[model samples]
Target chain A: MTDAHEIRHEIRIATGDDIVRIRRAVRTVACAARMSLVDRTKLVTAASELARNVIGHGGGGTVRIERLISPSGVSGVRMVFEDAGPGIPDVRLALTDGWSTGQGLGLGLPGARRLVDEFDLQTVVGEGTRVTVTKWTR
Target chain B: MDRVPILKAGDVLLVSIQTDLEDRTVMALREDLAERIVRTGARGVVIDITAVEIVDSFIGQMLAGIAAMSQLLDARTVVVGMRPAVAITLVELGLSLGGVQTALDLETGLRLLGAGPLDGGPSEAQDRR
Candidate 1:
């Protein structure tokens, strides 16, 4: 029931150094949301993975982080990563553990999903991909 | 390029990663650690990650690679001081770190490496001081 005037942070993810910045930004917003340390770590880790994917697979993108207030007055942190690189042809396979297109461990997507309470993925073949995740504070 | 310091402690090398690691920096660490092992003839390495708040798949893979490389050079690698949250995220991410050994703290990690079968005889860890 809170207002939509929550603070939003936008970060450009183009290089490996940006990954660190993404994690730090997520940590700051998570802290502002009054999340526990453990929750904050989870969110930041997820953010790191998503940001890396944007750079490695999506050829670079932007990450948007914001403080969210649910209708029940519950507060949380949300992050959205968007990229215009070659989109995923099969999100299901991409999410499967141990399935990687790159030289990664293939845990990025699913692992990020497990760390957050809300997960949504949008992709268009030959266009781009967008991943959104949210972690609610208990 | 920012480099992580590697300290020599007798038969062991202690590497504490305190900064937010860049990919190139990690790549540099791999090469530097390998050269250091060859130069020092150290039998064990303890990597302290207590100050690191988040570990992505890339960093996780780097740790695993370092352990494997050290083993090839006849050195045992032990990772220690993983925060509880990092541990949880690593598991959820499906990375067990496979071959690398882990301990709760640097002290325990040194002891584990010293007592390892490859180490042989009593620990010379205190001799470095």
Candidate 2:
């Protein structure tokens, strides 16, 4: 396995404009990983959704983009969105399709999960929420 | 404040989203489009998203809202030039774009809008790109 350390690029999600920056940053890393166009689009779209959630629900936070190398030498891109706002009380309910607490289509979380290969969510009602997703290069 | 350009072609209004969209920009687009439809009395609206590489749930909702608004304004809205990846993403997101009409390209969308009577029938144009 490669070293646990990888280069991480951080972006502050303060406003709507920052979401555009997050997408662009994810795209650059995805392209550098040599992911195909379809994969790139998928990753970028997923990142966009997560970033929007950060701004709209999470009240803005930070997004970290990292280059990951698996034990088998497979490379991928990992994005982590962290927000310090009202946390989701029920993670299961939030992940369910068509279940949204905000004025959204309720597709942000589940839809992002479908677009990525690895998905992880951590949240505490009063603390905050963090979502990490990865798309490996095929 | 970068606004998407809205062009008028004969009786149709063409809007091509060529840049990354912000939330506020999208809201402005909705308002601008509604105003243009009223001023031009356009019978058809063609939205070209070929330049856009991604359409998340937010954008998908925006498109659907625009289509519904156009329908209410007595204008047929046809969304064209969706990238293959974007289409796949939208479907995966479980967004059917409900009432929005789709076409493969601008030409087909315009032709479809022109050939049919407003509110007569659905366009026969294939949705592929």
- Provide all candidates' interface root-mean-square deviations: 1.0, 0.8
Residues A28-115, candidate 2: write the lDDT tens digits: 9898788999999999999998998898889989999998888888899999999998899999999999999889989999999999
Q: Each model's C-alpha lDDT?
A: 0.89, 0.89
In candidate 1, residue B110 scores what lDDT? Answer: 78
| Candidate 2 local distance difference test against the native | 0.89
Each model's Cα RMSD: 4.1, 4.2
Model 1 residue-pair collision total: 0
List residue ranges in candidate 2 displaced over 4 A.
A1-7, B115-129
Candidate 2, residue A102: Cα displacement in angstroms equals 0.8
After superposition, candidate 1 runs with Cα above 4 Å error: A1-4, B115-129
lDDT, candidate 1, A1-138, per-residue tens: 446446789999999889888888888899889999888988998998899889989999999999998888889998999999999999999989878899888888988888899999999988999999989999
lDDT tens per residue, model 2, B62-124: 999999999999999999999998888888878889789999988778888984334446545
